[model samples]
Target: MGESFPMKSGDDSHSYSKNSLYQKLASDTVKEMIQESVIKYLDTDKVTSSMGSTTIALADFGCSIGPNTFLAVQNLIQPLQTKNLEFQVFFNDHFSNDFNTLLTSLPPERPYHAAAVGGSFYGRLFPRNSLTIAYSSQSLHWLSKPPQGVNNEAGIHGSGAPEPVARAYSAQFEADLGCFLDARAEEIVSGGLMFLVMPATPDGLTQTELSALFDFYGYSLMDLADKGVVEKSRIEEFNLPIHIPRLGEMREVIEKNGCFRIERMELTNPKSKVAGPLDAANVVTHMRSAMEGVFAAHFGASVADQMFDNVVPMTPRIADCFKALHHISNQLFVVLTRK
Candidate 1:
């Protein structure tokens, strides 16, 4: 599980400065898929009668400032014009998240009222069984804790070796998986929908793979830290707690809750034909807000910029990263319906 970082509410200057580059590169496809998945679970009869009066509260878990969120709302509302369900959308992240920018980006005329909810999803954020739908993309891999018995110096444990570290991560994964489901069970209403998209290995994530990715990210960040571009102390304070749950692992979590039923499970390898590596990096940057702490802790403050710079000038390298990702089937898309 990934550790939580303190988020900034409203328009904090530091928040904007830190996340600007990332927000620029949000992915339209990710937004579209989320919208589509949620729509699939709408109670049509209930929605039609509401006429924008019935409260249909939707949440974008770990939502950040970017076009992808707007696109998600666009896709959600377009299908609801006829239904006219009163929309109350909440953009949720840690307190350190930039809520102001997200609000500013939204149109004032939108029927929905948007608010930012701070804190980790491993805890409750809503009234029991109150939310109508919840959506999270590329975010679930972030766990709330490092594997047990491993200190922060180990760089998120299990990212270094295959023996005890892997076991530690797996144990932590099982515990966090339970926490996530329990929290969601309390929050999502009966018949509600939840959509999650994240990076995962075929047999679930192994410590070795996690270690490699963490090493890459940590090395990149340490490089910037060496340049005094970002504070090394801050890096130490932050924790990159991601646990890439396999399909079975996720199923185990959901089933244990016995509140949500799997509606769809897909493994997507989205390929884009952009000009070159820079364009590819742009896609990554857009996705960065969701990954801020994970990369930042390792690469320091300049990590995001460095990643963009590295990918921009090197097409082959960018292609290679993409290819490597695909080679391992690194992404997963899942949709669940409330029982």
Candidate 2:
């Protein structure tokens, strides 16, 4: 199974809390869309009636240590609050996530009962039919584990992998997402809402800027192996736990799961507040914040540090690779309702 790797913890320069601007931009981009979806598809009256209560129970899956998670929760809650209903908000992530940072950083005077639930969302975390809403942003692309039968010669990321390797990644994603929907189907009450947002490709699109970023990293590792700084066998054994699904793949998984009805699905282009493409330093920092733990776990911390430090100065094309990062419509946003 693909192990759960938590985002880099703490509030320092390399922390996920500080480096997750792209995710924040995504949440901001979808804020209005989420509100509109809530008003349009969230059956608050039905939720209350089905659950025999006024306190609506909601959970944010894969909620890493963040201000982004808080923003997303508030956006979802605001639409429901207009109806004057009570809420019990659950913040969930892998067991190793920094709950201390996540919980303490919550807005003071926030109106709602709050608690943290730690576990993989691929399995059941709550009692059956107990939740009124489920939300996950920038989370679902992570498979429960790296796929079996993939090796270094196939490349590191699904976007740049060979055909057979890409198929392996897709198969793993389908299975993982199936488990996720099954768990949610059991936990969520009828008429509850589920909203998902993550990076994904549209049908027939072969490459994305995100893919190029990973391919760049793969090349860096290869260069390191050539210099005898890292073993070639190590690269062969490693695969990133991320899979960017195409639109059709997502629809297929939801359909196969037979749990929820898809209400809205589309691709969105998030506009960054910053003026230009991220410089090599910021780009590397952002990638490290989310992925350093994974790399450290695969390679030792010292080796991982050397690899990243070497990547910037050795590769001048990194900046050009990410130039159109924000301009592309790579994000998948979908709203579903429990049947």
Candidate 3:
């Protein structure tokens, strides 16, 4: 799962950077979750000498770009700074990530010194017992690749999948998540804390409007394939590397790992409503930004653009994106303590 999906770049039209603006609401939700957890940790628990030396080592895995990452780090640092603590923050992503934008735009002075570490969170990146606090937001749902042997013609649309296909996806998710826990367990100290904010589905709701939206895009690809713009097999091979987990599924993975205790878990959203099509366009751009790189890498940029352009008017069904602050959708937050 070391494959890279760089956010759409360039200053034209809509790119991953622009698409990520919609995630601000989601960012705020996670930032607050981290802040509260930080407060709770400070109240009752204290880190050992190895865990909390003079500097608190923090890492935010899958940190995309500026503004949001900046805000998240700032939120985490403010509470620590008040307690006379310093930080060594590491911003991590895949190797092909836009580290330049994130590194260059960092503030002239801040509470923490920042560095970039490139790798997949599904494997170990840091030394044993190094990270005092670890975080990953909107990143875990991505499987290393589409499930092997599954015929997901409609990509990740749970509604479009047959029983076997869904089972294959679930198996892949379990394997990926297991690897994530094993990696993080080695990186974080015994008493360290971790904050995970991931996309989720409610129990029994296999598909959300987001999944439906992706399903529609898969259908659109078939439409293009019918005209010979792209091969039908291309669509079949191009599944989004995502699997939206349910809250219970999340809990099961954490508990099964045995290295971490679930201190808190919540399923809620920002409840912010997107105004209209422009905001809805953010949804399209967000997905495009995430999937375009893979599409272009596998096919060609021309095909990626052609298919993306065909869906220009693709606003999500609702005002707010399901991944965003939409009231109806479930945004999952899990706070864990390494035991």
Model number with the top TM-score: 2
Q: Candidate 3 residues 163-264, lDDT tens each? A: 777778778899999999999999988888888887788777766656666665765677778989998787777666778887888888778888998889
Candidate 2 C-alpha lDDT tens digits along 1-339: 457899999999889999998899889988999999999988788888878899999899999999899899899999877686998999999999999999999999886889999999999999999998899999999889888878657456835577888888899999999999999999999989999999998788756656777777777788888999889999999988889999999999999898899999998977455577656677677878898888789988987887778777744577776575557678899999999
The C-alpha stretches of model 2 lying farther than 4 A from their native spots are: 272-274, 278-280, 314-316, 324-326
Estimate the overall C-alpha local distance difference test score of candidate 2. Answer: 0.86
**RMSD (Å) per prediction:** 5.4, 1.5, 2.8
lDDT of each: 0.60, 0.86, 0.75
- For all candidates, the clash counts are 22, 1, 0
How far off is residue 48 in model 1, in Å?
9.2
What TM-scores do the predictions have?
0.72, 0.96, 0.91
lDDT of 1: 0.60
Q: Indicate which candidate wins on lDDT.
A: 2
Residue 271 in model 1: lDDT? 36
As a whole number from 0 to 100, the lDDT of residue 2 in candidate 1 is: 44
